[model samples]
Target: MNFKSIITSFSFTIVFAIYTINSQNTIGETEVFTTTNQAVGNITFTDTGDLVYSHHPFFSPENRVMIMDAKTKTSKPFPNKAWNTPRTTDDNYLSNVLGIRNDENGIVWMLDMAQRDHVTPKIVGWNTKTNQLERIYYLPKSVVPKHAQPNDMVVDTKNGYFIIADEGIGNGGDGTNAAFIIVDMKTGKTRRLLEGTRTTLPENTPTVINGKHLAVNGTDLLVGNDGITADANFEYIYYGPLNGTKIYRIKTLDLVNEDFTVTELDGKIETYSEKPNNGGMSIDIAGNIYLTALETNSVAVVLAKDKSVKTMVKDANMVWPDGVSYNHVDGYMYVSAAQVNKGAVFNDGKDLSTKPFYIFRFKPITKGVSFR
Candidate 1:
């Protein structure tokens, strides 16, 4: 990420990477909250409105789970314990609770990944105000040292700490670690970064998914770092790398510095480009940085100012999108489409979006966030 400090600061990461590649979200500003996104199933919001969310078939070794009800968008089936095998395609079967964090006492901090040899892979907590289930983080086998794989997470509830991303080759092509894990959601404590850190390898470029090469044996096709978004005065941490075109950060006291020596904090890295997509990120309330860029079928934005990158929205139904949320009390923005290269190991098996994997809602032409 510090490729010669971005090739000698490349003019301050190229004018903030051209504001993160022309960051746009033009909806004529001011639309204070709106949802009920068709097919939305994994969301959260409630003062007393009861908008909880869950639905994931994405890491689908099949057996998708569910639980929705964002103001009667209606949904149910949400099994726990890695969704206990509804029919087993193996891989814990439960996928995509894809990192959600909310606080100020409403309590919502979850990040799920289950499929550790089809079981035992956890880092959980969900108490949307005592609706149940809290704490079950296990992964000290060197944080899944049996071929690592942990995705999308971020929770630093003011020093409780968390940061996970280990997009280590999945969708068959089967394992060979690539990491970034650091947890301590109050002593569940863990650590492992850039596992084999090949410059945090990823950027083989030439992804397609529903149309072709979703990369497998030509660079793991891609490797590591899925998503981590936490900013809005939370003081930095916006990550991306699932074939990343550059989007990074390092400073939560040097990525939770445990007293240096992960090679001097992976040599203190930093590069924040914008041209990344493959589901993983969410941070709004004017800290804009939402993601999903499945090869430009589009849905991207990364602007915490001085770090601007944009593509705000590019319809083609924003396909392949995979999980995002920033409701901010009704200024809606949620996305999901666990196509994941229409699986069958990156589509040589058929799934190129004839449609049925969707969950989108928009109206974001940002001025950050306008909550009234």
Candidate 2:
């Protein structure tokens, strides 16, 4: 009796351990790579592996952008302090920024919303390799209308263009005015397309986090045309609203062509896949689009072939994951936990965000564009 009982107990314990190991493996590995005091808006990596990120303007941080040392974890105003300092006169300082990406040439491109100082919205590019200001392309009223919030962008150096998603909720307008803004790098010409289209506008449903609907002053949050990304080949642009349930993509060729009218371009958009209310997105070489599933506190992937949505990883602390950027140096994807839902605007004028915001990283199924 003693020998048989001992043998059976040992086997049961071994099988239980194996089952536990397998269950943990299916969830994947996520590391808390960095922590910061300021709520981060977005993040990208330079060729040298330095971490660069935007200080979300919603909280009115002292600096608009900062660069951190990978090993030391020290932070400094990116480019220099002057670029972040504000002046009464019109200057080159970044007013407010949310979108940022690193190009193949090592240029850290920042999308400055210009909401703080009432200046023109613009894209500021800082070359990391050369350590100088590369360029700044201002968006006129025609290209970026009033109440337009140019939140995120995809830089397609392969196609010689930069595309920005205007959420159209900057000051007070609803999500109906949301659209896409295309910039011609060579000529600096810009055009607004698909304004008020179904693909660009947010779903009428409120973005409910946990069990409560996000709201400010009595109006439910209506973020539009938020997360956006382009394929590695720059063939198609994929995007959806922050309060959306479906993702959409359009051919790059049809988007840039002047021949297509507004109605024609609207027809060219294809419903790519279903998704949860997400913040930022990045696409891999294999066409897997990684999205930050805000409602579920997880990262989801939309497969390229069949377009099935799957949860890749989850973390209870990763609230309101705002940005996803691929790091070519480490072959991992970095994501920022913006914690926007904890901000005062959403919580009856009381900021509930905890100190020391977190940045997480995990290995992707395949390699992705570092510049995205």
How would you encode candidate 2's per-residue C-alpha lDDT over 1-372 as one tens digit per residue? Answer: 599999977875675355335435333457799899999989998897888999988899999999999889999999789999999877689999999999989999999999898888899999999899999998989988887899999998988998999998988878888989999999899999888888889997688888988887888888889999998888999999988999999998889888998888888989989998888999988798999988877888887768888777778788888899998998989988889999998888899999889999887766777688
Relative to the true structure, candidate 2 reaches a TM of: 0.93
**What is candidate 1's local distance difference test score?**
0.57
Q: How much is 220 displaced in model 1, in angstroms? A: 41
The sequence of per-residue lDDT tens digits that candidate 1 reaches over residues 147-177 is 5666667666776667777777544423236
With candidate 1 superimposed using the best TM-score fit, by how many Å does residue 64's alpha carbon deviate from the native? 10
Cα displacement (Å) at residue 342, model 2: 0.9
Q: lDDT, candidate 2, residue 157?
A: 94
Off by over 4 Å in 2: 1-27
